[model samples]
Target: METSKETSSNLVKRYQRYLKLEKGHPENTLDAYLRDLDKLLNYFQGEGKSPLEAELEDIEHFAATVRDLGIGARSLARILSGVRQFYRYLVLDGYIKNDPTELLESPKQSQHLPEVLSTAEVDQIQQAIDLSKWEGHRNKAIIEVLFSCGLRVSELTQLKLSHLYIDEQFVRVMGKGSKERLVPISPRALDELGYWFIDRNQMKIKEGEEDYVFLNRRGAHLTRTMILIMLKQYAKEAGIEKTISPHTLRHSFATALLEGGANLRAIQAMLGHESIATTEIYTHIDTTTLRKEILEHHPRNIRYREEHKL
Candidate 1:
């Protein structure tokens, strides 16, 4: 559970098992559901109740509480989804007579396009690195791999030296649910990693950490938080103001491919998205980009552009 959690009940454990063995929820998704469940249970505790006894009004109040805490609509929807699933399971097993979440209204979430770094912005960030520092070497490599390969931060952190098939121009990536896929590595990304290797090889590699590809000064695999912090600092130094995170690179990768005329299914496979629907979000970004370009350069829109200029 994230933030605050109440004592978990046996029912929660059983539902967790069902989600894993039966529903086949991926590991990260399972963790999210459990965390959301914690949030729900904690809220219910404050009401002198449990999820098993939660009323429709009680659920609505919980949703408002989550909103008050400033969770975004999409996240609130996910948390409510977890709650709905739990009640559904309880009803399925006859533990409850009614499903309180059945009529619950989820918050509306708009389809917002994610921020993408232009190739120039990417180069600017790379140039901002101070190569004299050892971290600069590793950070540069990290950014290159992230942009070039489009890995989830967890997948990147879990990457192993043996997973790199440099001669074949691919790296074996362990994606969500422990699934494996091969993502092509750009020469530029590989070259940065080569430089990072010079520093990595000289270190007294720690026991059991020898196989991991990216490491901290302590020789352990870099945590996901470390990557988040590093990217923010680089973004600031590069003076690109839009919010950035590991997912931004991944989103940019997909959008770039779509704009370059790559098949949507191909991009989905490369990103290891289980559903094509999950990969379709890039199309929205591509549409926004297309519209911007048309308004900026299309001869017919030139006057309109000038008229609309802020």
Candidate 2:
């Protein structure tokens, strides 16, 4: 029989290789899994036990301990998922007799809806920007591109001038998995982008930051946190109460496109969603609008009968 330490070392090597080769998990995901497993290993060590020696009861005890530490269900679920994957690899590789976490269950989490802003509210926020200032033009351009593209904050910040195809009216976005997708750019957004680009050239850009589209006063790439701060200030100036974030702009963009009768598949492609099912969440059918549509188009409602002699 393999020693406990030897078995653990082998399991760790196999887990890392599995994540890299078989699973194709991203580096960040691999890091998170390693961290979670480290915590489990540490707990086992403190209790004078080894992961190979751990049974269902030990797993249950670990879950109870984590719950008592006040970790939320969603977080606990993620931790459990990491642990389960590690053990599954161990079992498949014949390092363990049976999967110790075969009965482990993830905690249930509540479904939360994405926040969105109304068109009127979006307009009010845009109107609040003072266009006279140079930064105002830049800010307006930022908002337009954000809503027009449905980009994540990181994507927007990392945007490059070379990605814009103003003549073709489309911009190439680098999304998750390093995948690239083309999103249409509105004429207004293109025009604003033109002005921002002109102003951008006037600044003395740092050596390595030349290609970045959005820049700070120092002419470096913008950060995600800075975008949030900018949006918050704009929201406060607009006096709209609904909480807003850079993501809110993305949500508003999707909502606007759906309301304008854009095709679901086209929207999914534009949003760079890997799965169409993920994109389907954005297709919210308003009951009030559906009722109005029925009233307008229903055959029985449309058929008018003249008063007949009785």
Candidate 3:
């Protein structure tokens, strides 16, 4: 029989290989799963119990402990998923008789809607930029593309100059799961991008970084944190009090497209969302606009009395 320590090490190795080969999980995902397993193992060790010999009660207790430690339901759900995967692998490898987490259920999570900025507010933010400086042009282009394309910060940061088809009025974006999609670029955004590109070419781009569109002072790719900082500064300068981020621009983009009568499927394709339900949140209709339309077109509302008639 394999010792608990040996079994644990072997299980970790197998999990790593499974994540790399079968799941094709990214490095960050793999790291998070590994960390979850590590916490489980440490808990087992503290109780002087072997992981291979742990019962369903031990798993439940560990989950309860995590809850008491202030871990949110979403995080707990992810940890449970990792544990279930691990146990399924163990069972397949003949190390376990049954899955310990078979009866476990994920905790309920609240669904929050995405925040969107109004067109007027968006214009206000754009107008607040100081256009005298070179960075001003670049910032404008960044904000324009963010709203026009509905790009994730990572996708925006990793965008390449080669992916732009300005003449075609479309840009190819690489989204989550490395999925690629073509998004139509508005004329105004295209003009801003063109201006920034001219300025960008004048800068001394570092080696091995020529393909990247957006770059930092060191001519490297922009970090996610920097994008957040830029949005905060822009919002402050614009005197906007509501909380906003690069993601807020994406939400605003989706909202605007839906309000403008864009097709749901077309919006989904542009957003690169695999699930239609994920794209449905952008379909918020304006009740006030609907009421005005009804009042204007209704036959009863159109009836008029003769002038000066009582």
Highest TM-score: which candidate? 1
- Stretches > 4 Å off in candidate 1: 1-7, 10-111, 276-310
Alpha carbon lDDT of each predicted model:
0.77, 0.72, 0.73
In lDDT terms, how accurate is model 3?
0.73
Q: Cα miss at 263, model 2 (Å)?
A: 1.1
TM-score list, all predictions = 0.60, 0.56, 0.57
Over the stretch 178-285, how does candidate 2's per-residue lDDT look in tens digits? 778666665557777888877887889888999998988888898766777788888889998876788788877766666666555555556667545664663464
lDDT per residue as tens, model 3, 159-190? 99899987776678887547776666666677
Order of models, best TM-score first: 1, 3, 2
Runs in model 3 with CA error above 4 Å? Answer: 1-111, 276-310
The regions of model 2 sitting more than 4 angstroms off are: 1-111, 276-310
- For candidate 2, which ten residues in a row score worst on lDDT? 301-310
User: C-alpha displacement of 234 in model 3, angstroms?
Assistant: 0.6
